[model samples]
Target: MENNMNGQTAIVTGAAGGIGSAVVTKFIESGVNVVAVDLYQQALDVLIEEVGTSGGEIVPLAGDVTDPLLAIRAVELSRSKFGGLDILVNNAGMGSDMVPLWEIDLETWRRDIEVNLTSQFMMLKAVIPGMIEQGYGRIVNTASAAGMEGHALSSPYAAAKGGVIAMTKAVGKELATKGVLVNAIAPALIGSGMLDQPWFDEKTKKQLLERIPMGRVGEPTEVAEMITFLASPSLSFSTGAVFDLSGGRATY
Candidate 1:
């Protein structure tokens, strides 16, 4: 909530999505410039128009996070626009159909991994150098509760998110002494468009809501607030960790 970020800059993937847009807005409120990246041009445009920054600014870039060039372009925009990059939020992801692991096709399985996991790796690979050179950076990976508990009928999505958590730990330790902190957040049943997907029938949604002791889904703004702190200079001495945002649903 405190506006400590005066001249900081960041790149946020899935910036047009519910949680992603909220994260961008929070950063901008805290006086941090943000380069918002998403695949849909219309969505990016609509977001840019709606969420006009009050203090800092948002630079919307329409591109796929899976593309290697998109990562490079985002990094360059951060440097050129805001002088340097300070934070990177890998928040872009989607779920596949509600099918058993054995029943899913190979291509769908691979696509799930690419969008949910490999894309995060690619972004981190492109952004870490600038952070290393500066000796100060914050990286937040958006993981899912399914990854931790291995949700039924969403094996590919679960597997990819699990990989994200592990990768965050490995990279966080690798840069622990380098002044760049990396962490992940595992959220369950967020109240977003994700719940409207065809994979989530009324029964499926009800079953998921029952898991949260709070009896409700998490708000995107709540996740954004946590992300703002982790991406700020105030977050010291914590890295390679997983933050829980499951409304009391996280067992671990």
Candidate 2:
């Protein structure tokens, strides 16, 4: 809510998606320049047009987050456009169908890991050096509630996200003394387009919502707020932590 980032730059992957778009907006409101990346060119264009009118600098790059080279390109774009990178939000990921572990194909399983897990690893590898050089950085990875609880009939997605959570903690600890903080956010059933998958029938959606104590789906802006806080210099005491956005569904 505070415009503390008067000159900082941020890289937000999946910047055209529901949660990613909210994060882009949040950073912009806080006076941070944004390099929005997404696979959808048209969507990124729309986002750039909409946000460009707000009087802040926004550079939209259409690319696959899973590509190893794109990570470097994104960081370079930030440096070339806005001077340097201060925050990296690895929010690009996909969820597989609601099929049992035994029923999932090998290719789909591999894709899940590539998109949801390995991509974040690549981004962190590309961005950490600059952070270390500057002696300050904030990294936020998007993990799902399924990562922690292991959702039924979504083993591949769960496994990949679980890996993300673990990776976040490992990286966070590795860089705790380097002035760069890394953390992960585990969100439940947020009202994102991921629910538009054919596997998410009305019954499936209802069942997932019923598990939340709040009895409602979360908004992308709510998750973005948590991300903004973690990305700020104010978050000094916490690193390698999992912030829950489960609406009282998580007791641990």
Candidate 3:
């Protein structure tokens, strides 16, 4: 239960959302210093205030995660504030339109890929060298069940997450012997504000729920628990693997 991660530092993107916040909370509870990243400074402020400094110090970095410079700033913050970075949670992502592939424009498609996949790549590029030098690191990326099953109307999102899965696998192997562990989690129908995203109409929501044999959406905390494990220093043997967080929606 105790990860002994008190002095470790982490950068968690999407740190203001349901699952992101839960992971941040769990990290703080484990005594890990956090550089919380998200879009809005106000939201980051609220999260920092809510968490306080009782467990561990949390520094907020608000910016567009898609901006490549944000990655540099975040890593710099981690190093300057907490000594060195030990973990990365690439959990920020978004998709809303329900258009089919043909109906999708190039800009929208590229945007989805940029937000869901490329930004994570930038982060990995920025953080990996430090981790390699320090000789220890953990990275947990948030993929989606849509990526694996290829849901009908969410092609770009599925493609991006699928890319994330593949990228994680490739990079994980690239650094397998370097003492860094990389992994992705694929979750289906999580009961977060994502359910409220414009694309998930009532019919779509019902159909999605029906696909999960558990007949309900997953809690954010459940996802957070697994993310925390992947970020732990104790996870030495596993790397470049995808972990399922689906509630019976993913049997593969």
Of the candidates shown, which would achieve the greatest lDDT relative to the real structure?
A: 1
Instruction: Between candidates 1 and 2, name the one with more favorable TM-score.
Output: 1
Write one digit per residue (lDDT tens) for candidate 3, span 125-152: 9999999998999999999998888889
Candidate 2 per-residue C-alpha lDDT over 97-157 given as tens digits, one digit per residue, 9 for 90 to 100: 7988999999999999999999999999999999999999999999989999998999999
lDDT of each: 0.92, 0.90, 0.91
Please rank every candidate by TM-score, starting with the best. 1, 3, 2
Q: What is the lDDT of residue 27 in candidate 3?
A: 93
In model 2, where do residues sit more than 4 Å from their true spots? none
Q: What lDDT, from 0 to 1, does candidate 2 have?
A: 0.90
**Candidate 1 lDDT trough over 10 residues, lowest sum:** 1-10
Ranking by lDDT: 1, 3, 2
Question: What TM-score, over all chains together, does every model reach?
Answer: 0.98, 0.97, 0.98
| Pick by lDDT: 1 or 3, better one | 1
Q: After superposition, how far is residue 97 of candidate 1 from its true place, in Å?
A: 0.3
Instruction: Tell me the TM-score of model 1.
Output: 0.98
| lDDT of model number 3 | 0.91
Per-residue alpha-carbon lDDT of candidate 1 for residues 187-239, written as tens digits (9 for 90 to 100): 99888779888878999989999989999999999999999999988898999
Clashes of each: 0, 0, 0
